[model samples]
Target: MNTNRPIRRALVSVYDKDGIEVLAEAFKRQGTEVVSTGSTARRLGELGVKVTEVEKVTGFPESLGGRVKTLDPHIHAGILADMTNPDQAKELKRLGIKPFDMVVVNLYPFADTVRSGAGESDVIEKIDIGGPSMIRAAAKNSASVAVITDPEDYQLAAQRVDSGEGFTLDERRCLAAKAFARTASYDATITEWTSKHWAKPGTINVPPVNADESNDATNAAKTTAPADNPQFPPTFTRTWERAHTLRYGENPHQQACLYADGLDRDGFAHAEQLNGKPMSYNNYVDADAAWRAVWDFAPQIAVAVCKHNNPCGLAIGETVAEAHLKAHACDPMSAYGGVIAANSTVTLEMAQNVRPIFTEVIVAPDYEPEALELLKTKKKNLRILRVANRPHTRTQFRQIDGGVLVQSIDRIDAEGDDSANWQLVSGDPADRATLKDLAFAWRAIRCVKSNAILLAHDQATVGIGMGQVNRVDSCHLAVERANTLADGENRAKGSVAASDAFFPFADGAEALIDAGVKAIVQPGGSIRDQEVIDAAQTHGTTMYLTHTRHFFH
Candidate 1:
């Protein structure tokens, strides 16, 4: 180890000049020299630090338009040499290289430049040639070097380097670990960008042969090709970021988060914190469920009330206020401490009505000033969010055992076409209100488990039979709840039903139909779809087939 090396010497170069000058000045005050390269040298010199440029140490001018500034062996050997090895010390001495005990570096503008709509060539050029090399070198010799990346590290790094001594062994190890992660994220960004431009983002809606999911074999490049491109088949994929954290998860002991798609990171409507405290995990999850349910209505005012990821109340009215009232009336008990979401703005009258309810969140496009004040007075802890446009992206993810499962978001209910594979199995076609109730029931059922059944009336979920051991038991449970919530008005006696998957036999449907489930909706892919149809016909019940099955487990 070069025993004659100075007690403190730092080489500082960074793209973000956030706290560079102060760090440089501190290094100088500690009786240690501050060496820099290119713009860093000029910036530190301007700050009146006796800055030594890289060219002065390496004895070579930067060529290749200044890209060759810090690629010299003099700088790298100092950072990479094994300080514990006497042979490495002798080699460094023969090469006349001084040890660099500290290297402060942040990468080139690649992440920022590519994030902007920069041209492909411009983005490729921004990848740093020497910064990552220096960082990796210093990190490799962390036992003898201190490396820092972020602006938050400025004070700690300066104190360690000028703390009447120098950095301890453990601190250098932590700094080196951070440097490695910084490089990894940088490389991932570059890889993502290469995939974006090479594969061509937003190219789709074509036949298999004509599909643009293919690329030219002759132009295949390592960076441009995906991680497992042609061998595994490249399916078009999209991504969205976590917009906000919720207060809590399904249970208080668990945690949760929510995300809004179809908006850039800084888009105004994407989880805008217009008012109130931060949301909880459960609050965010239910709010997302509510908003996603209502966005399907599009260009109209519809309200959804969600608790535990299932909509308890939902309604569409001529005005937002009417929708809120009708939906609130659907299941007043379930709506307590739930999440409310609508497709339109929160009006003063609607907010006035909603203010009395103990809701955890209210999400919409906007809120009137009086409405905001009214809601603010109701609950200081309530969370409010504004989102613009319909959320159209359909990416759902689940984490399990160090692997992530990605699937298409449930979109079967969006079509509103219950007729294609649907059966008018009973005596007559449904009325407008019955049809609406049937649609709502089907949408809610699909969100449940495989052997799921939903009984709904008055535009609200009467009861949901989820994850039952048998289809018959699930039907019985749903019918019982429907009857219990019927208000003795016989709503369940004339209500609609929905199932996520087809019943293997007709008994489940027959039992529910006989129990006064007037209509039914299920995916009609089973071989016995005809028998189920026949049973519904015998029971004088109406049936519809979604064809697309929603089997959540």
Candidate 2:
């Protein structure tokens, strides 16, 4: 088998014409025969490169509104023929079809068309049929043909052509692998879009069971209604393109890289980094946590300080600067070297306060010019990111031992913030200010890890304890931090506390009450609910039950 083959004949067809002129010039310089379809041929001709239209080789005009241009037998036979085989070479000669040494093709912009909100018919027309066929055929015959699917590879291909070396066996194989991945990702995108927009939910057709062997089990299985069709499709395919290779992973010993969903969406994954070194794995993790935490209070000036994928401080205020100050004051020691995120734009005032702190990353929707200038000058090593403020309602994925666990995002619903929905189970009714603080604490608590406790006053966290083995320990830790970290007076005094889950006993509530907490909010579903309520009433502490637990384990 020949390890190196010269590119004497080539087939090129692409929707994206970027860098096509350079490749055409290289083909002209190397005296390589080129055949392209329709607009591609026109483009190459306009670039002063001689080209043969695909129809001239196939002896068939493009039909079906150009959909049937490259689907002919001549085009594919040339791509798939094994020239090393004498029988195949003789057959190709008899058919008057020349074999292709190189195939350059890129598929239609189906994903982009779908994302543009085009009509069904318009999107369907954008789905290319002949392109993938040619790509796969050439890729399968990589020993003889080099397939190019991305325009980014045009420069490399042009250089190889200019060098007169064509492509080596290893180079062809690598290109083949990339070609297959491109097709797979394209098909997965089409499948996902069709399942969500076109497919209808219906009962699965089950095979008939023998009457003699039929039982209740078989009958039940035959009629079981499946989950929603779009959400849980018959086949699930996820594809992400590599975005960056980080310096290291969570630690220096672990290797890691970042992948993007290949969509024009808003989130930390697609955020633009304006300053600082490349983000590390842990930096992305903590920055994402903080970004999500602050967005929970959207349309308001909210700030979150996160460390190790857990929020140490979160607060909402009238301005971004005030919010940052209050959130930072929650636990300055914990906020040191933490990631910060703001729901609103970062202002000059906010940057001034952040300049003194040692923050690993700061992400927000936007940044004022003065603020950005200050941060870029004062903190050259800090990762400053700008992400668009958009609703993030996508599903979440977590890898397990052998598979992945998928669930919808645990978004704070409207009921979670409406004080009227909360049940006043113990003590006097909370006033307006106390109810506001309770709502803020409840929303902020979801950002903490399981067995979490958060104390808030004036819509800013004063204390937070998370990742404890028991609720009692978390309660004690929160109170301790509140009082010990107070700037002047006890921060826990007249503060509202939020628990992620129900307390098994009354000791947790007793600890908070003893720390001067005036109100407590939790999902009341414990077996000893009366005991817990009695403890709160005995201490004259206002308590509200949300009936919804936000366990974040």
Candidate 3:
């Protein structure tokens, strides 16, 4: 690769002209001719820079209302012609086509226009076709051309031309990579928008192809699948932009960064930090856990305290202050240096109650003025975030070793009013008073890791045991935590229990019953579900089958 190639002729066409004049001045100083399109040329000429219009260079006027401006042999050949090949150079000279050594371009703002409530047809018109074409042509011929897509890169281009030298091969290749990514992201945004608007539900009228009639069974199978089971019309594509770099990853030694699909996204990704030092990686993890746990009970004054991505305490109350106090009493030891989230605005009384605790972060939909001032006075370094209370995405995603795993979010109605799948296959159905706490425990347990158990009394968490190796162990841990809180007087007595999954055997049910759990809620899918129900009956305890598993891991 040639390390240094002088940029003698430059073409500058862009929708954003923030730094175009400075670039034009640098090109003029280097004796490089500047060629541009309609508005770009007019703007540059007005800035007192000499410019050549695209019509003069290409010998064709801009047509189709500016859509067919740069898609010409003259423009593409100038960008793609091989300067090193003698035969190619001779052909270019015979045709009187001058080679372009540099291209500076920025595409139309399709994403911004779509976001700004523009009409569909208006947004569609803003998608730039010729700009990406020129960018790709210049990038493909990076050996002889330099491509610049961002205004931030103007300084790099100016510095090289001003140094009496040209761009190195490495610099050109780097810029080419960026140009390709820009085009790809732009196309993906357009695809997403079109799919959302045009792709609708309809049955495929075509009959399924018969596999037995074809000699090649594999081909027949592929052909019949789409007709038999139609899916969404467009292919799925993901796009993300970098948010910022984190201080570190899960540990201080590892590096990490955050990225989001959009900047206006709510929740932890776009939370407003009102008062605090910068949040760490662990703070983000815990804060997200706490936030989602609280959102499960939104429109209610609910509170969730989390540690290590597991909820340590959860409670629902009529007032924010009462919820904070009750949630803190669930497991005071585990709540140390934990993250807390509230469903409604944090009141001043709630802030004062939790201010004495050594909490890492506090998050809510909003905060009262007095509450915000009190919290800032209490701890200068505590992270306080206010989310905009938006609806969460329907899908959840996680990264694996080689690929990603995505699934529909567990938006089960824990209260059982919206679901017809719930069953009461046990000694007896939970009464109205107990069912409220059962629903509370069910929602809270879903945010914990697998093999999870939670015991609640009067809509407040008494104990939570999560991430155990076995269901029986989780039951024991929950019982132990409750007993410790009650000073060995059996606080689990008459409390409702919820599990993330079904019990494999009757021992877990018997254990919970012996520990004074009066009622239970589980998914009820194991083969020994009858035995577990028998155990519950034998211990004189009631049980309800939700028929829905809410496993987090």
lDDT at position 474, candidate 1: 86
Local accuracy of candidate 2 as per-residue lDDT tens digits, 226-342: 444355444578677788998889889999999876544565688899999999999999999898898888778899999999988899989999999999988899899999999
User: How far is each candidate from the true structure, as Cα RMSD in Å?
Assistant: 6.3, 3.7, 3.5
Superposed Cα deviation of residue 485, candidate 3 (Å): 4.1
lDDT of 1 by residue, 486-512 (tens): 475544677788888888888889888
Better of 1 and 2 by lDDT: 2
List TM-score per model, in order. 0.81, 0.89, 0.91
Candidate 1 shows a clash count of 9
List candidate 2 segments past 4 Å from native: 84-91, 112-124, 155-170, 199-225, 414-418
Q: Worst lDDT window (10 residues) for model 1?
A: 260-269
Worst 10 residues of 2 by lDDT: 221-230
**What does the lDDT come to for candidate 3?**
0.84
Model 3, position 176: C-alpha lDDT score: 96
Ranked by TM-score, the better of candidates 2 and 3 is: 3
